[model samples]
Target chain A: MAFISRGFHGRRPSAGTKLPPGQYETTGFPVLSAGPTPRIRQDDWKLSVTTEAGKQHVWDWAGLMALPAESPTVDLHCVTKWSKFGTEWQGVSLDVLLADVETAAEHVLVTSYGGYTTNIPLADLVDGKAWIAYGYGGSDLAPEHGGPARLLVPHLYLWKSAKWVREIELRPSDVPGFWESAGYHNYGDPWREQRYQGD
Target chain B: MARAAIPGRLGDRLRWRTAEVTGRRVESATAVTLTLDLPGWPGHLAGQHVDVRLTAEDGYSTQRSYSIASAPNGRSLDLTVQRTSGGEVSPYLVDELVPGDRLELRGPVGGWFVWRQQQTEPILLVAGGSGLVPLMCMVRAREAAGSRAPFRLLCAARTPSDLLYRSELRQGAPGLDTTYLYSREAPADSPRPPGRIAPEDLVRSGWPPDFEPTCYVCGPTAFVEKTAAYLVLLGHAPERVRTERFG
Candidate 1:
């Protein structure tokens, strides 16, 4: 049995508030990164989607802007146990980005500017689920918050939404990325509270 | 690659263990340092964190991540927690918890943010408020290991009274240089005006970027974002500087 501290009662959530197990609601968007924030100029930034067969679909800043954009208000859950609700973001859906690309892969390895990477399932990236978020709160996304562009997978742990994201490599098999290979769960589903490997 | 450097049982599956609160020390008005006794505890590197889980009588449970504040010792470690206003876990840990209390925690969580004794290059540590907790572990670890690596700490706090580890930091150790920047208030004899850390402060108090020193910055999100930006603008390579931001 887990030990319960004496006279300890956590704050009770409101009647309608929805959060993953072990998560507490937070209004602030905390930044967690392994390295310093990369200052990527909008002109120099590019997003690439490469399939297992080696076909590449690359989008420059202007090209990405030309694509139809969606404004999404979603909740974000970090594996560290903070959940921010109803956060607004602006970006193109992954569905739009992958509409023309052909792939039979089931997994994706998201790579960022500073050597950070996280793996996700290809199914989670389509069907209006994920986005390559470039703006937040009606303004250009700040670099500290994965500015220029970052994958926004709100359904999973925020880490799955790799910050400073640059490439999405579709893979036929699951390959753990930086945190995954280290200790974080390979499939970071917040709802399941699958934080660590054994969990 | 960061995991490869972690020593001992930490490389294995991390399991939740019972941590008994052996002692506690008041750090500031809103912060307290907890000394924990964990049986079968594996050693941890400086700057790693632990996930503290607390369950209620009704089986409702929540967890929070806290950085380890003490140097690695057998079967024991310390965590300095700052009470966030309206927070669920911190208030309990800081105000209500006492000696002999037991909690569940799984730990030594981070790899990239750690400081190992083998690192010999000149080190720069920039801390904002409670962010000093992990960096203090590095300082203590350096002292414990008798390492001669040059260490420079630039800590920003609201005032001298808000500073944690004030007395110990005053009792300086060898090969370590300490600089304090007060964002709101400073003592009468302070060298600089009260303000946020600027690029010049990095040049004066931190190792020059050319020194290729490994830099660690930790703090609240805004503080870290600004300080890290200044470090990079001052010429530190993006890869050489590591950061950990707290909510």
Candidate 2:
């Protein structure tokens, strides 16, 4: 049970603007990171997808750019209780990237350049549900906002879209990543208001 | 990779505790510091933050995160709120909330961006705008512990008037060096011209990269990005520099 503060009437979003429970709309994009931003030159960047059977598929910056890209304008919901709608991003769909990869894994541990990691179900990454995004708006994604490329999973909380994403390890069992181990929900679903472990 | 120093169940830390506003102080033109008294508050590190929730009579509610401003002090804590134009919760926190008002807040969040008293290494705190709040807590913590850790603070603000904890910073403590960089306006006796924090400003104010100081950078996204990038360029290890950025 929650208690109401005296005379603390908060801002109620205008009707018809859809937002998840316990979230408010924000015009500006906020940056949340565990540590300093990693500076990876485009030439030195590489992304690898390791399967449960130890099969590895690697893609250099050039290889990533060679793949077809899609422009996705999706809504973002952050566990921090801020939401942004219709954010434009350009990236290669996970379906296209994983089309040739063979995997029978149930989960994936997404890793980034700065040692940041997040876990997600493999089912959530396929079927045009996610992308490896490198561009935001029109230009290259800023380093502060995970430049070069980031995993774009709009269906879940923004943290599910790992920034500066570099590797994906498919595993048989679910293992909590950085934030997940630090008290965030392992399988973050913004619509369900699953921001923490119990919720 | 700093984990939560407080030992307890995650549920307890995330639990919403009722706190009454015991004291209030106007920090700046648009910022105010409220002292909240939580009856069963768990202690938190210097750089941790709290999530504040406000509910209306009609069941509408919203929440915002604010950094802890005061050093660990039993059940009492300080949160400095800056009023952003058209902001939902900040306006109420800065302009409307008063003493004796009760608010629900779940505390001491974010283990990564925290400063523990056990750390005796030199600390470099780079703050912009209201980012000074958490760093100020670290400074106060150092003083409270009587730890002689060398602390250098490089604060960038639009003007001196925009700086929080102005008088407290001016008082100055031993082993703590603070450099003020004003972007818009500078005082008459100010040494440097008014401008944004440049790489050279950090080089002069911050410890040499060779010293291996733990750097804490907090502020707006742009400020934190630029400052952190400059620090890395100056040869500081990326792992040594921790950041907490706000929109």
Candidate 3:
């Protein structure tokens, strides 16, 4: 019967601030600009891969899990400056995805719903530790965390970690992602601590 | 679900140290300075911040960012931490943590939020309370960059001690135009004027009527929101003004 909730933190939280358990992922991940999963049902979730050469790939749930999977203990850096470290995730390595495919390109372009697209350098895309996650923590990846599938980049800034990813296109050179195109730093490195003003 | 399993040599975990808390001082009721060891450290740019995370015995953890107060390239990273009454982490950091206690920290994050003394006009930095951390980075960076632009900083604090880097601001005040506004207390000896920085006051900050200089604003949400509003009203374009919000 109240008029409204304050919905205020009083002040903006400084970078590196962490929320306690039970509070983790409470609000979901759109805050990361990591796209949300489509509202459709399980049968509706699909992933597609297109090579710059025009070869197209389409996969349903079973097909994606059929690919190899892996995980890594990594820190996720955000343009907002919050670096969530020690998060464990599971997915098929991007390297594994390209294992049977051949391409002369050295970069990747990841696009999801909500117009979220990110570019990854060829080497970064192939990190043995990096994976196309089908699950997170220990369960099937929830839709909020890109559900069924997501691209987990443990080393780079978390923004490079694309959610609800549908396509991975191989390109010849480095390209910027949506936020990067908007003023975030390119090739975001936590150790380098490159937060914004990409070169 | 369980944590997702990815693979990698966790590698050298950024050769970090517990960084012994060398000293802790009570500058004000709500503000404190903790200087820690960072010997032989690589310098960071001005306006950069460090990530400080604390974990509970239950395994729940949180990492929050703090700006570097230590001099650029200095041996230690001095962070002037302010306690927000309801803040989950900062209160513990200010009231509980002690010297010799190590903290999990990483340094100097942020890029565009920096200042280059060279090729710059007199620097204009807007900070509220501890929002001054990164602004302090620009001050140090400007000195290191050796630019001649008169560095200027306008800080809004609740009081003198609440002002995170009061001494440094005063010492560095020779060439800069520094203001300290208190929402709570005012010192009899403080040279700067006292009171809130209203939009009208910011508009009359004494610059040439036609001057359009680079301006950087950092502080709490409301401070940043209002300050930016005032700057735009004062004729500074939106894009020309940059902001970093510190809760």
Candidate 4:
């Protein structure tokens, strides 16, 4: 994107410390979806991790709940330029979910219930960087916000989080999915303002 | 139609521009339509939206997205704002801003939700509240292009007073059919009772899914979700259903 003068941003001066350029802080959570929200029941929900080589690891709701989980306070930066700070989420870390799986893939393609998919570097999912969260703000994650388990990659733009996530596929090469193929940056980093292709 | 140029200049799609308010029209008690005159404004397609930014004198700025309510006029566009209680931007745009004031905006964003004049498929547009703004462009574009494509709109509002583009919609266009549902207060002598949009309403008022109409749904989150779900449940292909959301 060509540089454009943003004029004065003197108000909310303290927010500049945490917010990325071009983003504002929002207290009320906004719901943005391309289509309808899917109602996936916990009894029918399962998450799977697949390898490009064809190995698959699946976990049902009970199994996921039994695993040790953490509630972390994180900041979410949406590609649309809203940043919600200190949001809390509870879920199993990707490190824990992928600990048993061995793969040579360098990229991960996350899939969700509504057929939404987004790609991210495999490195971004490991080492405490991400989770498949089922709780938010001390309550069960609402379906409107990608409940029944959504991928929460707080480090990147919120689109990469992949709401209602159902599967994660490890691929040998990077592959763009959904928004990535539809003009969004293949790998979104809020701080760098990598929002679209060739940004 | 050259795909309406996908709404903006490269590298400037997200860049903010100063749009001078040229005119205003009160659409309803709670809504006002603002005409913006932009320099070298890249034309936008029906169903696309722009991000309107408001900066207070103290440099406190915020922005929200609103659909373009005007057809492709090349030099200017119209954005209709509905005042939301306690909303920072909507109230200012709907009640306070004057014709000479300048507003910052960026868009014609989202290429996917647009309606191209050349498309010949039957269209089923379902709108809730102010969601009618974007779909109205499609209706206007159909008339502007002089295309006779079969088009229908189902608009749901709290009451007749809550409807936007009241006169224009009432003075129908060729091939345009509409059904108005009042959830809170039905007009006297109205045939339909006051109620929310239901599955039966979709089957009764919309093009049958077998007709393969491209469905465009826009509204508040709940309304869009429920309406689109009903469309799919009625057998419209998921891929054929397009939606835009606002709250």
Candidate 5:
């Protein structure tokens, strides 16, 4: 068969760069969701962290922004194979939010306003690895992009970074969330191309 | 009574199978429909999509998801490709591929947006640009099943020339009503101004709010976002409006 060369859709990483395998860099942000975008009212929005022991911590939209917010520039890789490099987001680190809360949980289930939920290791949420980002590109996050507040877990596939995030429930053991129960890998590390289960 | 089992290769969803291009037809200037013959082809519901992967000689490959344009048939299905400018796979599929060529595909993906023959509610389908692909499948499925479900399609295209399935849509299907909204070029006899589909278009062409039509909106993210929002604002339950965002 002859070589079938096609034009590159976007920029490709230089050698030795850390863009994930089987992924291409896209300058444009792609909106992906299983259902309609939830129209959440800011005045009514709240972020809560609950432990299996019934202890709870809550923060409203204003109170969350009043906390120490930091801007982090990171690359987001989606299981759909699109990666955006050097995207800037502003939010409070999950470490700070969980600092005073006491929990012996090993798993965290992030829930959103739209009834979307995704699970990740409790370790993945703390130690400065995750953020409850409410702003992107220096502006208030748009609702369609999981704005107001979306969990940013830069290391895992974007699906694990649940959009419209509102709550984080700490559990003693891992339970598969929405996509995990469907067919996606539980721990979606784009570097290993862990897209589907058993990958 | 015993239930009929799902036939064909109901195997792993991630597994990619080789499909041969059995037929190709120019759907429009920018689009072509490639008919594929799959090995152990499992039939798909209306509105499902398949991922097509192409490999270069160097082994570099890329995949894109395209909606299945034809209704359930034998082992054959049609994928309509629109030549997206600067797109990696679309240009090749639209202009280069010929009959007898082969590609790897994984699917009948997406169960949410599907239209089943048993569903009796009125359906409101809104398409923006090439987003018409999946909705066309539902229309074709309705025709193939000889079902008389109420279906209204509001196709938003750049111009009359860009409208897909022009002849067939004009010929019409049983109980199907199609309205064309041209953002750039409207026909000389068009009653609508050349503009994007608006809330008024929904009120005028779509079923009334009382009809409780299940709406499926697909297209570029912007179009889907706007159309779905409008449908919900116009009194339809948020749950009734399903959307598929395409770039």
Candidate 6:
């Protein structure tokens, strides 16, 4: 519980209401997942890949992770404007994730906790490779930062790294998420400084 | 066939420079104001911020976003950075960086809390400490555009001297009523304002009933969450109260 609280704030601010460096500890890391950590119940928790033709193929969590788990080290950039580099991840490449499922769709919309969603192209999510990250660095991903699994699109930006992911709704059309809908760019491209409205 | 322009920089990133710095008051403990250096600037909207990244000799880097303190009239970027005791970034910004310092910043982010003169929605801005940065920008833009949309700015600070844009806000007085809620400093016989803006206090000092004003509250996340919850309880639509929470 202490760890989870710290995710919101890692360290006490030496400056006025400002957090110190990442090296500084805030609370502690969360021992438990705050939201639902999806189960790999082949029977219940199945991966449904929807194609542009509206065809949906279901696979259990294990089946999904089993596809092509590649360990790729890449930079993870957050909409918060901080970028953490050289992180390792494992999962089926989005290309492989959709390899079995067919789609003429140009775009894909990813959704997560509290209606937060982001849209990217089928090509973008799989630009190099996207992951349904079940592990981080080397260990099973801690729940404090989305566990049991989450989507890791290494290319676009971090907000697209949906946490506490429950569903992967493939769409031929594009739509934004809670943050994106509010004012953020549909595709949060850091290089473009797609930070706010009118940007 | 969609090829992104190859960025010459290692990450293929866009960079902003500090054209110059104008020394504003050191005011008590906080260091305020620096006129930015820029070539052709992409004018920023009020309530937007820019990322300031400093790379040490060893390439150790620190970056944080700060709301622009100056209104956009094709002028320089104004930033107010407050020194935090253990802060790796803010202290360095105020003490280490010099004018013409080669820096990298990118921004003009945040859309929810933006203040646009053409929109014409009555606005209420609530800020705390250095958190007042963005709201101050909005107030200036509104004033510069000669807007008459009733804007009410309430800034809460620990001490009188702790205020970041005290003089600026006063110098370019806002058309919207501005109030300073000081928690630590007790000003002479003014109506008893709560030492802290609590739920009860906010409810008692209710928003006027005339216009369904838009409220943009930016400050510490804790303060924003609590105050927003209170404002919702006081009858403001949850969506109507747009926010940009800073930590």
What TM-score number comes out for model 1?
A: 0.95
Give the poorly placed runs of model 5, Cα more than 4 Å off: A1-19, A173-175, B1-13
Error of 6 at B118 (Å): 0.6
lDDT of candidates 1 onward, in order: 0.89, 0.89, 0.64, 0.84, 0.84, 0.62
- Candidate that beats the other on DockQ, 5 or 6, i.e. the better one: 5
Superposed by TM-score, candidate 4 places the C-alpha of residue A19 at a distance from the truth, in angstroms, of 4.2
Per-residue lDDT of A1-199 in model 5, one digit per residue for the tens? 4424343233345566566666766779999876678888889889999998989999998889789999999999987778888899999999999999998899998888867788999989889899999999999899999977899999999999988888999999898777676556789998888876656
lDDT of 3 by residue, A1-199 (tens): 2111111122323457543221222122323321112333557777777777878777788887787666666556564545454677877777767777767887888876545678888788774857888776888886645666778886777778787777888887777766565445668776565554522
- Name the best candidate (by DockQ): 2
Give RMSD to native, each candidate: 1.9, 2.0, 12.8, 4.0, 3.9, 10.1
Sort every candidate by DockQ, greatest first.
2, 1, 5, 4, 6, 3
Task: Decide which is better by TM-score, 2 or 5.
Answer: 2
DockQ of each candidate, alpha-carbon based: 0.54, 0.57, 0.05, 0.28, 0.29, 0.10
Quote the positional error of residue B186 for candidate 6 in Å: 3.6
Proportion of native contacts found in each model? 0.53, 0.60, 0.02, 0.17, 0.18, 0.05
Task: State the lDDT at A55 in candidate 2.
Answer: 92
Q: Would candidate 4 be rated incorrect, acceptable, medium or high by CAPRI criteria?
A: acceptable
**Model 4 regions more than 4 Å off:** A1-27, A137-139, A192-199, B1-13
Interface RMSD of 1: 2.6
lDDT of 4: 0.84
Better-scoring candidate (DockQ), 2 or 3: 2
Q: Which pairs clash inside model 2?
A: none
Model 3 regions lying over 4 Å from their true place: A1-174, A177-199, B1-15, B57-60, B141-147, B183-196, B206-210
Per-residue lDDT tens digits for candidate 4, residues A1-199, read: 3222133232362534567765777787877767667779999999999998899999999999999999989999887767888899999999999999989999998888878788999999999999999999889999989998899999899989989999999999987777766556778999887876666
True lDDT of residue B129, candidate 4: 98
Give lDDT tens digits, candidate 5, residues B62-156: 66778999999989999998998887678888888788788788777665677889888899999998899999999999989988889999999
Q: Give per-residue CA lDDT, model 2, range A160-185, as digits (tens).
A: 99999999999999988887876777
Any runs in candidate 2 off by more than 4 Å, and if so which? B1-8, B11-13
Alpha-carbon TM-score of each model against the true structure: 0.95, 0.95, 0.57, 0.88, 0.91, 0.65
Off by over 4 Å in 6: A1-77, A83-106, A111-116, A121-156, A162-168, A173-199, B1-15, B98-103, B168-174, B188-190, B204-210
